[model samples]
Target chain A: MNDQEIIEQIKKGDESAIDFLYKKNYRMMVKLILKNSGTEDEAKDIYQDALVVLWQKARNPEFVLSSKISTYLYSVCLNLWRKELERKGRHTSSEGMDYGENMPYDEKERIHIVQKCINELGDACKQILIYYYYDKLSMAEIAEKMGFANADTAKTKKYKCKQELDKKIKTQYTPSDFLD
Target chain B: MELQEKIDQYLLDQLSPADKTKFEQLIAGDSHLKSEVALQQSVVTALGNTRSMQLKARMQKIPVSMASTGNALRLKWIGIATTGAVAAGLIIFFLTGTGQEKNTESAESSSIQQTTSTEISPAVVPTIESTTPSAESQTEKAEQAVVVKKQKNTGTVAPSNEIKAFDNSANFDDIENGNVTTPNAENSSAPANTLYTETNNKLSNLSVTVDNSNSKDKSYQFTGSKLTLFGDFNNKPYELLELNNKGQKNLFLSYNNEYYELVWGQMKKTPLKKVSHKETLEKLKVINP
Candidate 1:
């Protein structure tokens, strides 16, 4: 069933809708999350977290969906992946990140350069770039999740963080850093 | 479009094909625009790949039990409720005094006080009914009725010694039928309404135990000396008996059929009443006996 039908069933406390939702989107959600630099385990965690948020919010009487189920799921997974990066970055430096560019590049080179640059970037940079570019989250949503003052502040921070990431990559590599 | 905004949107794959062609034209001739695009493109690609890998790893680790979120939440609440109940039990055990001497002495004096106090106020006595079931069903129905009979002129006065005596009788009946499970089960066997002042030292040794396999690690206690004040006096006496369990003094209050652990020296001016002891006893009797 579609999200609306599933949501209606869920509102009635029908158990099957939850199962169907999980089964239907679990793999695609995982794949989307994996594209954001997470492993299968991280993908599962993000998927579950997204599912949890959806399940909890779906119970609210006023929740309305203005997008497709896949879009919503992708957004949630993307947000969760950013959070995971932020958490990991707290204890370590973002040194060699695996993501390469916004345009779909040669998947292999894209994966290698992205991972290497991501490894060099700081937690803050990793989170902002992943949210805006990979997850495609709005600046406002990113700000709210990260506890920033507002969307403008988050956007400013994102710009600074990206510059920082680019600088770090240039210092580490002699070639005109492919990842600006 | 503004230069930075245009470059930012172009790098993010958010720009339209027309804008993309414009960006390509600029990149072909402009060093700064080409450099900006190069940096942002590399960063975005890196982010996407890392996310994809992380998602793949997370998906592989999904637990078999992930579908049982509702059950998990229910179990969490059940654990909390059980912990609250056991903590309440320990509180009641401590407040009522525990050792043999104190238990016996408190049981004896409280019974006598209840009898004399009731005789003094004959008009207030309600019809006495024995609802306690037979020995086979003693644990199932150990109702200790403590009716503090009073005339219209007097307010809801304290229960008499007769009621305490009646509770003691019921307690004995519970012990005889193995209704209680504790080292201090002998004392708990007495009706819940038996009121003994803190003077009895043995009451300190009593403890209530709740053993559930799913229960948590922490245990709680209520000091008996400060709380057992429902005797042959007015309601004001409870205010005096109310002692706060500040800093782990271990005093708990039983009122309205719930146990509250006193914290931060905030003691109630009045004793909290509980759902009638008879009702709980009846429930216990049904479940156990």
Candidate 2:
């Protein structure tokens, strides 16, 4: 099947699609992990993780496959291995590292905090914000998916959700907490 | 427009050129505005991360039975073949030893045969052969070899080697201050060097194409990893711009005419500072060059 068709099957939770995806990409994922100092068992773990990530993306109504499925799977495995390497404190020079590894620790922490606050926004606000910002859904689409009266209603809901989210974050964290 | 809407637009890069310039001036002039924008940008980012994490959690619960059936069978075959090879080698060793002993005639010839048998025996035969009185000892050695080979075949030899590598490096203080010989130092570096070369090749060849026109909602794929950017506009179907990153994470692609800039970190098209196409090209040149 074509990429779109496969994606559609995955979205519908087709077992065959999942099987096909795992079968097709498992070798590449295993090879990647093995090359990165992981064992066959670890490769299996990483490949499973990558597949889960792909499955998650496929299940999301908002997710679009920007790259070939194999490419996307390969990227996921690479990132997982990089993170694994970092966690193990086995990170070598940039020659083998991925780009943007130098993101400030403080920034990462701040993003983590904001994510916690977003999660606390409850499912309604969370879905709306994700659809609007991350998914880049138009107001009309958001309204339709969210069952709002119209686009304007979705806009108002989104505005309020942002306000509520901002308030939650500000109340929990001071500006210094993030800056430091 | 409300301040929040303006910030959202600014973060998403939906602001007009004039408004974008004005927002930048505001950010530069006011620390509070700068922090507010920063906070807002973080919220957008957090939302993106939260979504990814949630999806990951869900994906983990998927049944392993859904994995390819062929893989399981292949591993089984490998295990069986390894077992057979170990058994075959043991049989050959025994057969050669018996045949040689029977063929030997004079004292000198017998002595030579004994020497040769003793020399080659230690390698395939376990140390227990000399010490153990029980016949079970032979089976034990064979089993051990099979077990070691099986573990090796499973690709699990790296973790111990990795641990050893770390331990050797950690003892550098001792090595520098004293004349201690580090046996594991060589063992550690061998795998790491081989792994590095192999990883580098795999990483360099890894590429993922970002389709600008695929999804109605402008959702970008991120795998929460470091990324290197490579832009290619000449591809057919969707305009292809490759993000050659280790893991696909938090990339936002903006399509203008035929040009595409796959920005790292920022999930939205908007950056706090205005970035012209010329600046983007310069950035790509820095990355690729």
Candidate 2: list runs displaced more than 4 Å: A4-24, A34-36, A39-67, A75-101, A175-180, B65-289
Output the lDDT of residue B109, model 2. Answer: 15
- Looking at model 2, the pairs that clash are A66-B211, B13-B270, B223-B248, B227-B245
Candidate 1 docking band: incorrect
Model 2 interface DockQ: 0.11
**Winning model by lDDT:** 2
lDDT of 1 by residue, B146-263 (tens): 1110111012223222221212112322222223222222221222121122222322233322222323322232344222222222211111112211111223333222333333
lDDT of 2 by residue, B113-146 (tens): 1100111121221111111001112222222221
Candidate 2 lDDT, tens digit per residue, A15-128? 455554554444445655554556766666666666656665554454665545654554456555555555445433323332225678788778889988887877999989
TM-score of each: 0.33, 0.43
